[model samples]
Target: MNADIKLRVSNIDKSFPGVKALNQVNFAVRKGTVHVLCGENGAGKSTLMKVINGIYRPDAGEILIDEKPVDIKNPIQARSLGISMIFQELNYIPEMTIEESLCVGNWPRDRYGRINWKEIRKRTKELLAKENLNYNPETKLKELTVSDIQMLEILKAISYNSDIIIMDEPTSAITNKEVEVLFQKINEIKSRGACIIYISHKMDEIFRIADEITVFRDGCVVDSRPIGEYDLETVISQMVGRKLENNFPKEEIKLGGEILKVQSLTQKDKFEDVSFHVREGEIIGFAGLMGAGRTEVMRSLFGLDPYESGEIFIKNQKTVIKNVKSSIDKKMVMLSEDRRRFGIIPVRSIKENVALASLRKFIYSGRLHEEEENKAVKEFCEKMNVKAPDFETKIESLSGGNQQKVILAKWMVTDPDILIVDEPTRGIDVGAKYEIYKLMTELAKQKKALVMVSSELPELIGMCDRIYIMSKGKVTGMLTRDEFTQESIMAYATGTKIQKEVK
Candidate 1:
């Protein structure tokens, strides 16, 4: 044990009924440095972090903080010992105001032992302002966007002023600019001699902020070294256990007739006059900055949100889609950007979640054919390479990547002609991302129309046949494959340049 070491774990082992989440994992973090944890989803990075943060008690291990043994039996104990964690899953009281949420754990008290509401509001306002978060403290958290909530989570962790801060996929839902701000905050924390344990699958962030890097695979440490000792290839190879030749294995496909079209879709203040089309076998992309109406447009198109006026056509026939079932009946399905909220049913089993959207196929003679449903679920799960303990395993227990696979499988079983996938690879690792890209390319080869909405520019450029750039509730520019560059896309996204046609 070194005096400079802020946190240390020796031979930590944790397990659940069917999974050994961590196997004799040993790791150390030095004060005043950022230690990055990189691994594929289900690789036990989160599990290890949970053990350290007291969310999960390790079955066997010795945890030492500052050369002293510590037993962190719960989150409260961890926090009391100067440890804080920002979870990947957004957990907050939706009904609570921003100020109430931020001041929940540590509230200022008056002389009478009651909460000092004024002081809390003042402090929360100051905190938000310092972070450049232009949000009202009185606004309920449920009213805020996902990106804003992500920023708030970062702020909440930073507010603790702890000795050790653990952040899991902090930038998964945020924009690049917000990520820059987060990095700056992290650096400030580092300057104060605090230790940061950052868990992310993003290579760019790993390279930018990590002082030391540790790779976890299959619930064990594969490698741990300084940032200088590893390149993107080495880190990725260790994480995925193979050389991924292409993160985006996009294949060219022949264009067919327009399968779906939206003309002048308006959602009052949400989005306006949004028009796009997806041809059979063509992958169309929607690229924009955060809150640029890309998601709103997709939501309206899927009938998740009501639009003031719009005309939707399927195979050149005007169709009125009143709800999700209506859209599904028309052979259209959507993979929402916020998967936790909209995509998966967390409390359900793997088989049930997979068979959710396509239940019609399993229901015969006024009953669900259990054997038939199970067979179909098994086939699709295997096809998607979903890693789960069993068909009965809870969907919430699976890793982020596997959960995404199940969601994809859910829609795939529906045999949709048009798939509107929003942020399909949001929080998953590079390996899982590659798998999804391969799947999308396969779908395109089958002449299925796909519309992809992504904040990641390179993904859109690599996978999209054509891209429509949205800015402030309108389609600012449309680019074909030849013109699909980050610069051109940003030009339209930021409203610096707008092209009228899709050429």
Candidate 2:
């Protein structure tokens, strides 16, 4: 064992009923550096991290900390050994206040053996200030957005003051500015000789902060090297086991008449006076910062949230969508950004989930036709390339990318005319992202209108025929495909520049 090695796993192996999640793997992390793990979903990156963090006991392996073997049987034991993890999914009690959530497991107690409210509030405020977060300590977690909750998780992990921090897609839900702040904090942690094991599918973030890179594929490590020795193309090729000629495989389609239009959509503090339209055979994008009201507008349009006042025209006919069922009745469906919360029934099988949205179609004589449902689900799953042992497998058992595919298949079975996809490719790998992009293009070719809300500018520019930029609950500007650039989009998204109309 190397003197500087902070953590090491030797010959680690783990398996589930039908899946070999991890092979005989070996990994090591040194002191005071960012070690990034890059791989497709289900490549065993998270599984390996779980083994080190004591979420899973490896079937065969030895774990060492500080050049000595250590037995980590649980997360508490791993924490005692100076290990803390920030998961990709947000985990927090909705009813708990900020202070309570920040000091959840290790609440401060006074001499009387009672919880110290004063100290908790003081420490929470200090921590929030240090992170440049401007939220009241008494604010409940339910009032916060997905991005805000994700930020608190990051703060909680840092509060542990652990020697080894594992962050799984920490920036997946945050804005680019927040990501900058997080990178600054990571640098500070490194300065104190703490090691970071970061996991992400984002190429830009990987190249920006990583000192070392490890690429995983098919439950094994393909290559590990210094950041300086890798390039974007090389790393991507190693991850998917092949070269991708085009990351965004967009296709040209002749757009038809306007299929859906929204005017003056208002949601009080959430969003106001939002207007946009999508034509048949066209893919439109919504681009903005985290709190810029992009997601809010989409939610209202899809009838997930109530809009104060708005006029919606479907196929040039005024339509009123009061709820999700009404929206679906008008041939509109949405794929939510928070997949775990809104997209899937985790306890159900893939077949059940895929047929959830369109179960009525499978009903005949007051009974669900099992043969018809099975055939339909199997066909859609194959078309989406959802890799799984079988359709009977629980949806939660699959990787993030595969879960997303199943969601897409679910909505496709509904045969919607206008599809609203919010952060469609979030938390998935590069290969899976290309597949999603291809699917979107195919939908456009089929003359289905797509309204995409995404924080990633590059994908929006490549995939959308037009884009509408929002800021502070308002639509600031709209851009055609030719006018789409990161700088121009950011200018509109940040309210630096605004155009009343683009004709």
Candidate 3:
């Protein structure tokens, strides 16, 4: 361990053509300590981390490793400098096996530089075991779930014998059990004198694992304090610049006519015998463990997947939602679980993306209503409080939270009869998440029904008017607002609830 500092980044400045991403940013990480980079989305957290890990070269300022300045021009150079970064959007070769993906950059070669398949698999298997990840080394990345592929990425960084590891929203797409395993691995690395920069929007995690907390806002450091100096409320206020008096603003919703009613919605092995009713002015929550098929059920309902047989009713009238187009035609919209994969279109402008699903509504014959569309987008952007250069700006430039807002804007523009949100607040920050919850509340107030699927227990319990627990592709139990409890939900979700208590 260096007596002075393990890593120092001073007055760092980075810009992306027109946008000044980072401004006079100062950051440091001590050896063998967990330093959390805390901030709302697009507060230059990612930019600063990229500067330190060599993804982006700073236009100004210096990065010092062990009291000496160094130039990290590329990822290879960064790896050579004993630095590794795990990005929020994971990078993996899906066609290759786990071992093959890990050994791609620098494989164990025989005397003639030929590939040594036997040694490669052996070492990869042993390394995974040491990290306590149970999976076949030869398992194809495509065959593995998204969570397992993420574990492989982490192991790949450790394989480089890195001393400094930067993790950005590492647990965003992971399961609860996988998170425990990751924390254990992080501790092992810390014990060996490694510095870890943990970047996340979840304040609970920062307080739990961080030695020091640094909050960033608008491309500058707001506070750099020891972990004990902050609590969840204090940290959230610093990050979002507000007191989170009420996280969920769910109000007493009046029961109204049924907006969506599904009868025997079955999707074969994924989810079977699923039946639920969502009334106007209510939030219906679907709760389950990671692979209990909660998301699958929602997707099936939204016409994103093929269902064997089912009948969907809207306003007491039967409708056919054979495909995504038909679903939208029926005035039903879905916010997907995986944002990058299904939710937002990265390459298009914010206005274009938000107005995509319902473009035909504004255009007549061969002409388009440009003014009306802009006015609509402007109104939605204001309603959602989206921060962006312009509605014409590309969706990729905004932070994860803002991108989510754009998705919400798009669905809201469509004016759906029933809204199905799957992991609506997956990677959004605290303030933005609360805003989304409020939006849902207001939508319910407008007699718009919502069916939400979430992994966060508090979210389901706090935001939903009613909760349905699913297990192994079946609806094990349903709980009303009065009966909602973590223990009860878990018991039902795991097939341990009595038949009589299910009602």
Cα lDDT of model 3 by residue, 1-503, tens digit: 45746888889988875577788988788999999998887788888878887788999999989978999897778888889888877655567898898887777899998999999989888888877678888788878767677767776776676889999888887888888878988898889998899998776778889999999988888988889888887788888887875658989988799888888778888887778898989899999888888888778777888788888888888987778998888788999877776777788999999888878989997888988888888888888888787888999878777888898899999888789998888778887888889899999999999999998889999999999899998888899999999999999888897344443
Order of candidate numbers by lDDT, starting with the best: 2, 1, 3
Model 2 residue 276 distance off true place after TM-score fit, in angstroms: 1.5
TM-score per model over all chains? 0.97, 0.96, 0.93
Instruction: Give the whole-model CA lDDT for all candidates, comma-separated.
Output: 0.89, 0.90, 0.84
lDDT of 1 by residue, 33-127 (tens): 99999998898988888888898989998899997989999988899999999988876667889999898878899999999999999999999
lDDT of 3: 0.84
The C-alpha stretches of model 1 lying farther than 4 A from their native spots are: 109-116
Candidate 3 error regions (>4 Å): 1-4, 91-100, 104-143, 498-503
lDDT of 1 at 178: 87
List, residue by residue over 3-109, the lDDT tens digit for candidate 2: 88999888889997788888888888999999999999889888898889899999998999998999999998899999999987675678999999888877799
What global local distance difference test value does model 2 have?
0.90
TM-score of 2: 0.96
